[model samples]
Each structure stands twice: as C-alpha cells, then as structure tokens.
Target: MIPAINIDAALAALTDHWSPKVVARVNDQYVKVAKLKGEFVWHRHDDEDELFQVVRGRLRLQFEDGGETVLEPGELCVIPRGVMHRPVAEEECAILLVETVTTKHTGDVETPRSRSIAEQLA
Candidate 1:
C-alpha cells in the first residue's frame, strides 16, 4: 500500500525558493510543492493548464493584461494554457501545484531559477 503524504512535512524539506519538488503523481499529473518569496518569470504553458493552491502565506499572480489575482491560504487558481502570468510573493509562501507530467517549469523561457524535470524529481 502507498503511504500518505504530509504536505507540511514535504514543504519543510524544501530549502530553495521558486524551486518546486514533485511530491505525488495522479494519472498523468504531478503534484508539486514550492516555496516562493519573490517574483517569478512571466511565462505560459502552451499545451497544459496549471493549478496553484496556496497552502500558506500569500501569492499574487500578475497577468499580461495588467490584472492580478491574490491568493491566501486555502485559495486556488487555475491558469489556462497559453496565458502569460507571473507569481509574486512579498512574504514567503508555500504553494501546491498540479500540472501535467510534461509541463515545463518556466514554459519556453529559461531563467536562473528554472528547474528541469529531472531536478524536480530528484
């Protein structure tokens, strides 16, 4: 039997900001946890939608249209495929991400904070 995952424990194991680690997988999707403290790159997934659920603190997703969505704990938002957005956190934040197995971390844009799938899995 598979063991249950403690989200808080999984989060505690993370030490890097903006780097997400794969915690679980359901069908073709991956459940990831990440810590954020600053601004992320503006990017979009061309073929896959992304789900962001705030576990702690606050997160603001800024869109290309100059609008933004702020999420607090227990709140979630879904970013549609091909929509450009950036996540910003004035304070440290913990988030849960649900995306397809093939989704890239920063879409097609490579940045210093970008992590490869292998890195995430590790």
Candidate 2:
C-alpha cells in the first residue's frame, strides 16, 4: 500500500544543500525536494526537461544565454532539455523538483554537491 507523503516532513529531513531527496515517483518521473542556499553549477541535461517549484523562499534560474527567472513560493518553471542552467538562492529556500527518473542532479556536470539516486532514496 502506498502511504501519504508529507512534503514539509520530507523537506525537514534533508540537511544538505543541492542534494535532492526522492520523495515519490509517478510514471517516468521522480518527485524530489531540496534545500538551496547559494549557487549551483551550470549544467544541462541532454535528454530531459526539469521543473522546479518553490515551496518556500525564492530561487533564481540562470541560463547560459544570460536570461534568468526568479521564482517565488508556489511558482514553478521548466528548464527545457539541453539548456544550461544554474540555480541560485540568495537565502535559504525549500523547493520541489520534477524530472525524468533518469535525470541527474546536476545534469551532465558532476560536482561535490552531486547526489546519487541510491543516496537520494536512502
């Protein structure tokens, strides 16, 4: 039987930045939550689109083309596949991520901040 998942509680369980926790799976996608504060690496997924939904505070998605989008609570934006993006949070922020099950945390770029699927599910 599937149990109810609490976004807040799952978010509270996360203690790292840029590390996303897999909370649920729907079809071919994974639902994840993360806490952001500072800047993430600029990377792009060659085969999948990613969605970021702000749960609290704010987030800024910067693109390689110098374009940027600021997201407030309840706001969401989809970063098209293969587009380079760097996520930034001036202050502490909580967010939900929706992406394909095979999507990497930092796209094709690997940093110290990257977390594996096993780690996220654990």
- Scored by lDDT, the top model is 1
lDDT of 2 by residue, 1-122 (tens): 97999999999998988889899999999999999999999999999999999999999999999999999999999999999999999999999999999998888998888888888888
- Cα displacement (angstroms), candidate 1, residue 70, comes to 0.5
At residue 2, give the lDDT of candidate 1.
Answer: 83
Give Cα distance to truth, residue 65, candidate 1, Å.
0.4
List, residue by residue over 1-122, the lDDT tens digit for candidate 1.
98999999999999999999999999999999999999999999999999999999999999999999999999999999999999999999999999999999999799998999999999
lDDT of 2 at 32: 96
RMSD of 2: 0.8
Report model 2's TM-score to 2 decimal places.
Answer: 0.97
- List the RMSD of every prediction in angstroms: 0.5, 0.8
lDDT of each: 0.98, 0.94
Q: What are the runs in model 1 whose C-alpha is more than 4 Å off?
A: none
**Decoy 1 TM-score against native:** 0.99
Q: Distance (Å) between predicted and true CA of 91, model 2?
A: 0.2
RMSD of 1: 0.5
The alpha-carbon lDDT assigned to residue 9 of candidate 2 equals 99
